[model samples]
Target: MRALFLSEPPFHFGVHEPAPDLPSRIQALVDAGDREEAVVLFQREAVGLPDAMIAQFRATDAFAGVVPLAQSTVYDATLARELSTPTDAMLAVDVPVTILCGQQTFPFLSAAAERLAAAMPHAELIISPESIGHRLDAHAATRILAARLA
Candidate 1:
């Protein structure tokens, strides 16, 4: 069976200009054992999101669930570091891999997807036209995956 990979690793994109201090600030909060505060800070100070969007996310149950896993972001950062060096063994998996990126996402993310697809023999990269920045249109993505799986 084939595997699908969605979203670029955190390190794949350079920091966006609006929130240059985000990573360090979140790290500081985590280091101080304030995981919830870290989550709050992340939502409040995310690089590209406007204030209204952040408020909308804050009101959602999904965001509530995400709050507890805030510390995992640190782990994600670590994983990104590890994945930075994509060795032959890492790319040698024989299964088909689909790497999807948003068309309007940060340029680095699209570039990372291209790099990954080029490195892996069985991987294909798709830039979704229906996507907005890093936010993909879920219905469009679902339909595409369903067609592929079918």
Candidate 2:
């Protein structure tokens, strides 16, 4: 299924580091003429994750592009909506907007989901796997989701 994944950073601060950190990332991306792409709202230092690990991120293809942001939804959506194209709007026409949040993204998940669900025709929260040495649960969730699509 085609999807749009958003993660509220800060919880996984141990996992990612945004290239520009939210506000700047948005500014840079928009300034760089990337308003028509999907941005990665990571939770920590993103540089740490290996390309093999994030190979699933087809932001350059599955998405128009990738965005690494900090923990600010205001900043997040501002860039998201502003740079959005008509086709971008159509992308969510019938596609499921799956928010793969982590266990650490607590109450914020609910609130974020609430906003996202309202904004998109299709959007739901799927608590990602626990962050362990191996992304066992994350992989499990991925397989489970894949099976659902199959």
Candidate 3:
């Protein structure tokens, strides 16, 4: 079976430094029922997308559809903690695993992809140079996946 994994945090990756206060700050907004502000704060601080891009996205119908789900951002803090957990059992599977990362993504994520590729016997890593931030070029990715499956 063929599988495509995108922007997956490495199992062995660890950030020992204290996390920024953004999570708590966002959580506070969520707790206070200001979910929209929490989402905006996360997009501004954590996602770090350009203001113009964010504005354009916010104008889209898709953004409006998902706005109500912003309250779930509170749970992201818990999910972030679990990202560093070991994944030896999953990596041990013999099926080929393709890990795709954007070349312009954060350094730590690239490092994690490299480390994951090293650990998995049947895994390969691809850094898409044309990708932006954490978003991949889906057309290119589909071609790569097709070749692998062939």
Candidate 4:
């Protein structure tokens, strides 16, 4: 009730748009039964991300659990069409909001955070220097939020 934190939300809010072929290309990989590859492609195309961060993710214990998660995840034209929200809707949010995006995240995502922060009367935008691409720097975010909400 007091505050809100949105970490790398996919909503564009009309700030920017992703490449035209991005969704179809990723979906093609998925339809070919390569959801893992689709995930990688999305990361790469969405933000020009290097493989290092994804390699780190794959090395984690959580990677094994994501196979099913990835299989169930759908990224197609329909989902893409629904990702953006109106700026007026964002402006109508009455609570103080903190929108967090990685400095290395997708251009549209960073732009969305900036746009939301500007539109919302009490919103603050935080670009996490420690994050890579769209992944939040949980430690840094925790520290900042703790201090902020204290």
Tell me which residue pairs clash in candidate 1. Answer: none
Which regions of candidate 4 are displaced past 4 Å? 15-31, 44-68, 72-80
lDDT tens per residue, model 1, 3-56: 766565333433342244556777889889887677777655543345686677
Q: After superposition, how far is residue 135 of candidate 4 from its true place, in Å?
A: 1.7
Model 2 / residue 137 / CA error / Å:
5.8
> Could you tell me the TM-score of candidate 1?
0.63
lDDT of 3 at 54: 72
User: What lDDT tens digits, residue by residue, belong to model 3 across residues 72-113?
Assistant: 655554455555544678768678888888878755567778
Clashes of 4: 0
Better of 2 and 3 by TM-score: 3
Give candidate 2's whole-model lDDT. 0.45
Model 3 residue 81 CA deviation (Å) reads 0.4
Q: Which candidate comes out best when scored by lDDT?
A: 4
Query: Which residue segments of model 1 deviate by more than 4 Å?
Result: 9-26, 31-69
Residue-by-residue lDDT tens digits, candidate 2, 16-79: 2234445565456556655532244332222233444445544436333234322343364454
Q: Candidate 3: lDDT of 137?
A: 82
Model 3: residues with Cα > 4 Å off, grouped in runs: 1-4, 8-12, 16-25, 40-69
TM-score of predicted model 3?
A: 0.67
